[model samples]
Target: MASQDVVYTSTENHAGFKIDVVQYQPTKRPIEDRFSVSTKSSNRLLLGVYDGHGGSHTAEHISNILPTALLSHPPEKHAQIFRETDHTMIRAFTRDHSLLRPKSKSSDWVHHAQVVRAGCTALILDIDVNTLIASYANAGDCRAVFYPPVDAEGHLRQTEDLNAKTPSEQQRLAQEHPGEDLVVVSGRLFGRLMSTRGFGDACYKLPHGTIGNWQHRRYIDALSAVKESGKIPMNSQYHAMFHTYRTPPYLTAAPEIGTMQLQKDSFVIMATDGLWDCVSSNDAVQIVRGGLEQEVDNLAEHLLHSVRATRAPGDDVTILLLHIIHT
Candidate 1:
């Protein structure tokens, strides 16, 4: 049975800094998106959002374990830090994918488990009060937008574009990979999935080995048979795109990382593609900045309500409104 929608809201405060969060599931699909806020110290904070594509397991697992995985490593340079963090996330995802492998399941069932082709995009932000530096890393389309303090007219100021690349940019990146075929099906990686890089999706990330040769042939044959029989409907043709044990390592978990100096009254917005799919970054910034000014404790809830009311039903929507209070 399809489950009902779920929405959650909460506030996390540390050393007078507050992180307002809202999580919403607009459709009946499982809430595959997960988020968490943690503090390394009174002056340092970490926030993350994981958007699962095939199922919630990968996202749930990342939500529960990624924070600790990150905290275990001490601070370092921006590039080194993001690289280390990405490796940690990849390891955690690989471990869980192996565990979730069903002993007797069919290829179709395994495909749905997110192990064969399921995965989640990751967006993480690290904030330091002392330096007012906000470092971010992005693996998929999940995005972060910054809204500076209001101007004389009370209009929110744009700090810079922290959002991820557009779909076209992602395709360009896919083509950059060696031996990736530069093939894009429906604007997704490998011509099948929306996210170009992320955790899990072993069939895409791992290279096909000796045993994978036969598996690859079987995979293509099965898909061909299914297509020829007209079993998959046109509207759902995307589902026919699954991963094969191809070599040369087509997909990756690497992230794009950068640092920005946060203005005194700056606030950062983080969310999954579900929310972005419906609401533009500019619209989200306006709503959230206004809410922050109004001291809206339910800002996350209000954002979800606006998204659900304004746009068509979307994927799981998760938003985090983080206000940095400089001491």
Candidate 2:
């Protein structure tokens, strides 16, 4: 459940910039209208993919809140703002819930808590100076992708020195690490009924210790009770979101932040459940690099178009694109 922080090394020269933002929310049935935008700025650009859960309010809140945070803060505090946005959104959801729910004596706003509990997965990719920073804050299982310098042939390829798990790679994730089980375990071991980490769903997770710890502690002996105790039991039902919760927390906001530089050709993408449900990072990268030459701006928009055109429309598809300009 370690979630936050970033710093990137600058390349020798900086040159290109492109940003793409898109979202798909199934308001009705036949058509899925998601939010999307493409922008080309003088030097800096912001591309974000916020895949929201529970309600349109939460999805929409990310659309509203992220811009405000970016607009309000200077470059230095952007990471801090990302962390703060979770609390801010939860508060906003709580407030908005009041509008939908009329106060009742017995109701006590308990039923309406789900609205506040609704959390969004946020992936913010920022290109500032010569550095590229990737920040991922998720309540559930939204994903982000970093495509390193492509080959001379201009394919969206990467030699993974260090990067976040690709969508396909993450599918293979067997289990959580010790101390990282905040979101995996549900209900009381002895009376602790809740998740260990996350944002929004405050009803289950705590300001701290919501995700269960999964890291392997140094076991004292071959058959020590304490070390064996830390292992999550197989066949033991647990809540990932409130989807598995007994009473259900239904909210979360645990963020994992990572960074790299434009030493080579680099493109970073952030997306919500819409694309992640089907598309893999490598799959998306091929589309991004193949859509258009990296030399031009608007790669982000092109990427959105590519994903939208190809992906099966079972859910909303949201994507944000940031292309490194190596001058």
Candidate 3:
């Protein structure tokens, strides 16, 4: 068994505001989750959490590039940025057909396939420090919750979860596919992926022969190599999914964006599903609230410890906490 690894970081105190981040990796496999924090200037701060499935490649790539991409574009263009980034990833994979040549090793093909088959959920928060306004964009199940509850005109602000299990998401898939009965089964997209929106996972996003004929053929060949190598089970449901893949772009990376004004002592927690799987939203808020009341040194780390006490995490857990305070 591999030992658990934890990463913790805290930013310098700025006008009594601070951010804390922590990640716990317990699995033997390389952690597929990635996160980033960019204090671009005194007035701007960017934070993101990416949860990758199938492999870590997509998450790592997004973590490295998304912060910069978001910073380059205006806040209104963030959704377009997410979609363009997904397209860029697919284009990069299609341009490298040499990896699919017969002479290439199966392992080589598998590595290249990661660029297309792996996908990641992204949740980004762009903050205007001086104004204490935060704009959030979410693409998957990763969640951002505000302590003391960010209420708008007497109602709590809510963000929908973009996954097959969500009723509206299921309805959207059915409506998009029309008569496709298997668009969702057992609360999964084609009974394979839980996320209905994210970056990468080109195999799910690209339609048959959408890429040039030659490139699509090479893509199929690479997938066959990956299967033959037994990296994935031969009888996996994905086999059926590929054969039945009719409508292209069964998933999307377009983020749902919203903004809120911050208040002193208000806390925002952004985390991957790994933490949410074991911790309830209300419980998480209480934990953070308690930490703040007690003036803990690192609230993110404290919340992580609280989660581990109940049960060992089955996946990589990441937590980012932003605390607003007065000097």
Backbone atom clashes (below 3 Å) for every candidate: 2, 37, 0
Tens-digit lDDT track of model 2 for 67-152: 55664554456556756766664444344334355444434343334334443455554445444443233333455566764368
- Candidate 1: tens digits of C-alpha lDDT, residues 1-327: 112454677887776567888777766556788998887767678889988866665677667666666665643443454445445544443443343553334554433333334567788887776787777767777888877634576554322222223554554555665454534555655565666666665445443346635443433333233231324422244234434224534455666777767766677888887777788878887787777778777676667766676675467878887776655
What is the total number of backbone clashes in candidate 2?
37
**TM-score of structure candidate 1:** 0.73
Best by lDDT: 3
Using TM-score as the yardstick, the better of models 1 and 3 is: 3
- What's the lDDT of the predicted structure labeled candidate 3? 0.78
Per-residue lDDT of candidate 3, residues 189-293 (tens digit): 878789899997777775466544334445665554444233654224445656567777899999899998877888888999888889888888888888878
Comparing 1 and 3 on lDDT, the stronger one: 3
Worst 10 residues of 2 by lDDT: 1-10
Per-residue lDDT, model 2, residue 101, is 54
Top-TM-score structure, candidate number = 3
Quote the positional error of residue 233 for candidate 2 in Å: 32
